[model samples]
Target: MLEWLAGGAEAFIGVFNEGGKVFIAFVTGILPTLIVLLTAVYAIIELVGEQRVHKVARYAAGNVFTRYTILPLLAVFFLTNPMAYTFGVFLEEKHKPAFYDSAVSFVHPITGLFPHANPGELFVWLGVAAGITKLVENGTAPFSLAKLALFYFVVGLVVILLKGIVTEWITKIIARREGVTL
Candidate 1:
């Protein structure tokens, strides 16, 4: 029992050390980027009053193309957390539950596709593209880096569209059932 307990404690310490290293690495890598992005976003919001921003958001929400395609594409191509914060603020200010639901659905997948607006994302995307090309290369492999990026882009767009549409529909149904206007 003593030997077993000692071995378990040793293994636990090793795992904890490794986990701490990974946590430190992730924080060091992402903290600066997050700080800069958040600062810029907040600065812009301050410059362009909340009311004006909400006006723009309302306009975007009214348009299907802008709401689904353009916004999601921008969010994915840009940084994720910053866009998420901006959208969250917009939702809060606008007080439109449907818009909030739809935007959340649209933003998350794009964030997943392109986590950071860094070269690392591009490299990872390229590697995945190469792997996919190798796997599917029967005749001439049509999986160029651009094509792979585009495919993921389209996938993100499709996910946003589906989620936004479904969420909006469900929200409306629930609102109606509760005798409330969405």
Candidate 2:
């Protein structure tokens, strides 16, 4: 499954690379530009909506921060880093319902949610989960630890590159629209 996904991503990259003018103009240029324009429009709408709901001074910065910074941060981190996903899970656990831990305990008979009840246990559980996923999906009983590490590293690199390109383009559009010299 991983290989299949990797192959597909490679194929898309190949298309972008070899398809030249048309593909680049669409995928690398127009699509991203449209997303940036949409983001700017959404930001404007949010500012107006917030001002209508409450005092402009009270909600303006928060709305801007959420749209321009927070959402972008989440997109970049989640795309590139597996560890970031787990970190978010940990943070979410704190706000979870009373039965959240109990639910985990009920499922996953072997691990019984015990392995993920704490931070230290959580990392161990993640490794076990990754190993099990690799095994079930590929018919390999167990996956090599080194291979898992390498996979994480590669995923991290992908997230970094894709996010960098997306955020940079979006920033350029925003800056231009806002009349920032940079």
Candidate 3:
């Protein structure tokens, strides 16, 4: 029993050692890129100024169409990973954005689908959609870029719209019940 336990422990340690190397390599590869991206984002924010950022947020959140559709789409497509943190800071400094605006901006498929702001994610998604289309069509047809784009657009739109609407409604309700103005 002692030998068996020792063997198992040795195996586990060996596995962990190899896994740790891989983890370290991944972090080393990703860290520089992340630092550069974050630095650029921060520098741009500073150059743009707090007031301009607040104005953009207010404009984006001015209406349901802009709030639910345009804002989230732009956040995901353009801002990528930094949108949430940037907006959080802006909200803290300006206190102008609504809960829904921040919520929708943060809760998008950008990071999951488009890590590092790479457009290659769209191609990957298109490939997946093509595979599904092939399965649906029994390998009779290829999926078009237009179809893939439409599918991506519709899915993104629905997610942002639902999240924004629900967040706004719930926030308003909670604030009203607590006798607080949002």
The most accurate candidate by lDDT is: 3
Tell me how far the alpha carbon of residue 57 in candidate 2 is from the true structure, in angstroms, after superposition.
38
**Span of ten consecutive residues with least summed lDDT in model 3:** 88-97
Models 1 onward score TM values of: 0.56, 0.28, 0.55
Write the residue-wise lDDT of candidate 3 on 90-173 in tens digits. Answer: 232222344335444443344333345543333454346547667667855456545555666577667767666676677677
Give the clash total for candidate 3. Answer: 0
Can you list the residue pairs that collide in candidate 2? 80-159
Order by lDDT, highest first: 3, 1, 2
Worst 10 residues of 1 by lDDT: 88-97
- 55-103 in candidate 1: lDDT tens per residue? 7655665565566555544433443433543553433222344444544
Each prediction's RMSD over C-alphas, in Å, is 6.9, 19.7, 7.3
Off by more than 4 A, model 3: 69-108, 113-157, 170-182
Candidate 3's TM-score reads: 0.55
lDDT of 2 by residue, 1-182 (tens): 99999999999998877758655655684456545654664475477673352332223223323322332233222222222222122222222221122222222221212221123233444556656777867887555645554564444334533443455456567767998654
